[model samples]
Target: MGNAQDKPPGTGGGGGRSDQATAGSGARGRAGGSAEKAQTHKASEKRVANGRENSPAGGQGQQGSPAVDTSYLDAPSGALPPHLARLKNEGNHLFKHGQFGDALEKYTHAIDGCAEAGIDSPEDLCILYSNRAACYLKDGNSTDCIQDCTKALELQPYSLKALLRRAIAYESLERYRKAYVDYKTVLQIDTGVQAAHDSVHRITKMLIEQDGPGWRENLPDIPAVPLSVQQHHREKPISVEVAQARAARAAQEEVRKKEACFTLLKREGNDLVKKGHFQEALQKYNECLSLKSDECALYTNRAICFLKLNHFEEAKQDCDSALQLEPSNKKAFYRRALAYKGLQDYLSASSDLQEVLQLDPNVREAEQELEVVTGLLRQSLMDSSAHTPRV
Candidate 1:
């Protein structure tokens, strides 16, 4: 009974072991096939989603597949996704190298990704739009540039770069009035932007020629910059060189304005003098002098006003100031002579007339006045001697 139960060891036991090994191998083979099929399906889906299936190189082997960018997958949580950041950086790099078309594509991809990701960050969106607008501008697509710039402005109002780019686009489109308004708004936001200042001037000339004196009325109302934006610009750090340049430009602008005001006032004063409105002319001259205190011509012109008004002392003082500024000013010498005559100082008047003649012998008025003053001085001296008692 024991020998029957044991069987032959090699025949039964060895055969049993062999059958178990075969079964286990088959199970593993089937599982491996399923895993390989799943992997192939996943790779196919990725290629389809990336739109590479129909690409010219897609028919090639795996080596022809587009390089996968898995950098975003390793991004740390709670920060801007690595993919978006990478796109922006690559766009900037391309733009710096003057590959505007390529940069534009990069920015477009990033913008679309942001939209799909539901990113609503105003500052980030604004920068992307503005950058795209710059690319459009470079491509000579004014319409698209304006649209992108407008979108940027809407996202971040008072954006200086957006306003400037939009203004340029509008000008390129021959929308002069809108361009003028946008440039003006840019200046209000940042007076230091020389490009904005120049654009405003150029557009103003175009608008004036197009719409005449009513150009301003035809312009769209300019929006006021928010206080927050103004404060932000004011508080922003600037390099030393930039700060110096800005200060120099501001000083030059101030000088230009003052000179213009001085010219206008001086012209008005001269007109009033021609009309014999001496008092009003004197007021205008005073304003002119206030604007240009060191101007020798201003002092001489004001002295004429004083003389016409019969303010002899004031006229004399103005002539004195004019002479101090220009020692050989013929106008000052002649005017001072008239002032002395008005004050009944015949001796001083005669001496000033001689000085005027010495400066310019062709001054007929001075020659005539000298004769009259000489006669008065001689008569006064004789009268004084006649009134003197014997000593």
Candidate 2:
């Protein structure tokens, strides 16, 4: 998460400064010192607590010197709404004290307060969500961290902090492609950012090692920030609250359309598979997966095509991804069994087939596969034993 340690500065936490100079000087100036003088001296011995300095510095100035001013105790935060400011202040306090859970709760309350007041400025929302993303990262909830950063980006796409946080979360999840894209976008927006530049180089090297040098050539383009929305805000200048609400709805609708296209692509992939066009089906499934990586059915279907093409390793990887998304998916287990069988891994094949059967005892395909694998294992063991010399 982008510099998650940079929390909003705490406010209203500085207690009133003690009148140090006056008290200390009076104690030192006392004459005929006795029990009362000693008691006064003891009472006057004070040090500013919590790192707060006594405002009016030094003792009452010499007769002709100018008086020290300590009137700026209530620091002005320049027109920030009181409720929102208070929430951030409290959240920052909790965050500094390692109370991340409580800090998140305070940040959430601030978000709700903004909504209730119809204050939906992307700038305001982005800060709140980004701060909350920091808390989620601290709590080791990278998924939620990504979600909050995404929300912040939807409001303010050019927010480098939000983009950086999202990239960090994606990297944590091993989604290297997504993280690389985000880092690239950050570099595009601000070429001077060393972190983004370093991240791009690091992730590029990793991608090369994982997928070979050609991987960079196939990477998707970095996404452009929607600065036009911010510009339009200035030009047309609708009520901020109304504009923010409208923007949110429009973004949601766009997401719905994207999901609909994802479903359509999946259906097309299924049709291609049915027609025995395994290569075309693979392409379609890949496209669907690009839009919805968490779809267990899509991954399983892709594994089916890989198996048809005799790409046992690729088929196993796809089945593994599907099972990661859905551990209970019998189809994934069965498909993986096929993959293992293709690779002549009778032991693993038998295990997966057994799991499939356990999940669905009525599955005839799994039952038959399990029997075949069991016999192969037994025959292989017997062959090995037959070749062994007596000891």
Candidate 3:
């Protein structure tokens, strides 16, 4: 975001000499005429000097005459015209000095020159627009900033600077949604931009509050970042500290996404359980456990699904796991008791039910179930004794 101005290529020039002595004599003779006549003579002499400088035959000429400054007549190969390049360089200098207004004028002049001269170099034009956009942003003219940035982007779609500038402009204008999209897109292009990461995080909360859970559906289409842009970013040089920070931020973002996914799956599992869709709930819980295997709630929640599905062994296993994580969980104890009863293990059922009561004595359901289980146990023992042979 600093400066955001484009640097112009270096200018070069060839030397030439002009016979200004003759022009000077003529000007002296015409001094009695209108000032316009003398001015025209001076301009003609300057043009002659420029023409001689550009001529292939022109070199150090007639021994004693002073050389004319013909540097303005030449531009670097494959660069913008000297006049336009000068404007751009001036703009960059002005921008660095915090003269944004003057910089804006210079960029505008360069852009106009490009149009007049039919200089259709997209890269050059894009830079001019982007530099001007920087000026607009500095001046707090966000609307103009957006417009210039858009123009720059149109000329060079993958312009990182223009995209960042436009995103800042959008945020300043309170167009949070667009700003968010641009910031996300910027990260896709170059993940090292901490500002984009921060802005995305800030805007995401605002959007979620404004549009509810379906906020993403209301956003504009975010274009996929090109692979070339990614490669370019990778090849770009960065400081060691910046690289380390970027990697750390990337890891944190990954964990945040994983946790968010886990929460969503857990919620969906709970909802499915409430709706009596035990199998679907089981699938959801399975995914949640994959993401967070040590979560006791996930095991307990899955145990309910297994119990509802009459998978007594699986239910008992899940309950056992939950208890291993939380020994005093009344729900785990009660659910395990139910699972044992389903397996026709009355003794184990009775033991788990008693444990549940020990943990939470006010659980009336456990008290009733324990009473029934104890009576069954007593009857089974008496019947066994009555039927016993000579052992």
Candidate 4:
């Protein structure tokens, strides 16, 4: 979520002098000074009522300029096709007033207008899907975001925006191999697209460092921008279901072909973790951890596996590691305490059991363990005290 408090310069969301700026959806009718008639409009007259230049991003401009430019009264956005533009302009007006959810409705209205106007081509609809996808992403609808990106890709298989967005969705869904492939493709499409190239390099290096398999190496080389597919005859766009399958398969196949890029791969080690292999539900949890070791739950999960395998030391170590990462983790404390008890380290077991009680006093299990450990510790202490010389 590269979203800062405000839009960055040159992104065109708000602020700065970039002709090519990105206008986020959600600009519509809101109360303000007159946006039409007798207004003294000049070239570069800063018609940025709700304009990106005059947007919140650029709102905090040069301090010397005293009175804020209160010229126009609408949000800033790219020019739409005619009548639709006017409608969006009104929406921008509302958006500038910080009416987000409402403004979104207006933006949808504009899209509907475009659709009604018979301007529904792959290229045209792709742009629409991209814009809508941005909206859904902002609203935190992962499913919708994926759907829109898929639709956009169907229109323009090589849409850079779609590829980047799809990669983001994959990353969120813990599909790293797919993200890597998308980044690689983005680089090929535009050799100068450094960000994509850098992401691919970094993630790939990380996987390799973890002894991740060769599937990553053998991943299909995709460009930063997709090559133009011959549009000999126009056809209706593919459905959302097809698009999703394509995205999943594209990512799944990439990983399936070679070594697994997930921690489950480490556990399975080229045996069951190979291509087209079905991973159980826990496999997802393991894969997530391999990409990032800081998650507490993953450690607990692995500890469970160790416990099942009767690897008491390994289980204790994982519990300790998890506790180190997140001190207040009750589950880690409880599990580690159990692991210590299993290893017959009564002192360490008692200590962890006590801490678990402190964190969650209602745990009947921890209480029972505490009762049992306390008697053992006290008896041991008594024996030791008896042996000590009266110094």
Worst 10 residues of 3 by lDDT: 8-17
Tens digits of per-residue lDDT for model 4 on 1-391?
1210121111222211122122223221111123331132211123333342343333335655555543433333344464455445544444555544434444455555555465555775565566555544444444555666787888888776677766655555545677688766655555545556666776677567654677556555654442343232123375465467568867877776433556554455234333424334236546766676786777886776666566789889889889899988988888888788778777988999889889989999999988887787788788889999997
RMSD, one per candidate, in order: 24.6, 22.2, 17.9, 17.9
In candidate 3, which residue pairs get closer than 3 Å at backbone N, Cα or C atoms, i.e. clash? Answer: none
Q: Assess each prediction's global lDDT (C-alpha) against the native.
A: 0.72, 0.70, 0.75, 0.57
Candidate 2 Cα outliers beyond 4 Å, as residue runs: 1-234, 387-391
For the record, the alpha-carbon RMSD of candidate 1 to the native fold, in angstroms, is: 24.6
Cα error of candidate 2 at position 273, Å:
0.6
lDDT of 1 by residue, 1-391 (tens): 0001111111211111122221111122123334444354345335434534332222223666666443432333223466666556656655665766656655665566576577888888888778877766766666666777788889888887788888877777777788788888887888877777776777788778988998889989998887788889889797566678779888999999999999999999999989999899999989998888999988888899889888999999999999999999999999999999999899999999999999899999999999999998899999999999989
Return the clash pairs for model 1, or none.
Answer: none
Identify the leading candidate in terms of lDDT.
3
TM-score of each: 0.47, 0.41, 0.45, 0.35
Across 1-391, the per-residue lDDT of candidate 3 in tens digits comes to 2634232111111111122332122122223344554354345335433445222222335556666554543434235876567556656656766777656755665676576567989988888888888877776666667787898899889788899888887877678788888888889998767788877898899889999999999899898988987898788787565667778888999999999999999999999999999999999999999999999999889999999999999999999999999999888999999899889788999999989888888999999999888888888888889999975
In TM-score terms, which candidate is top? 1
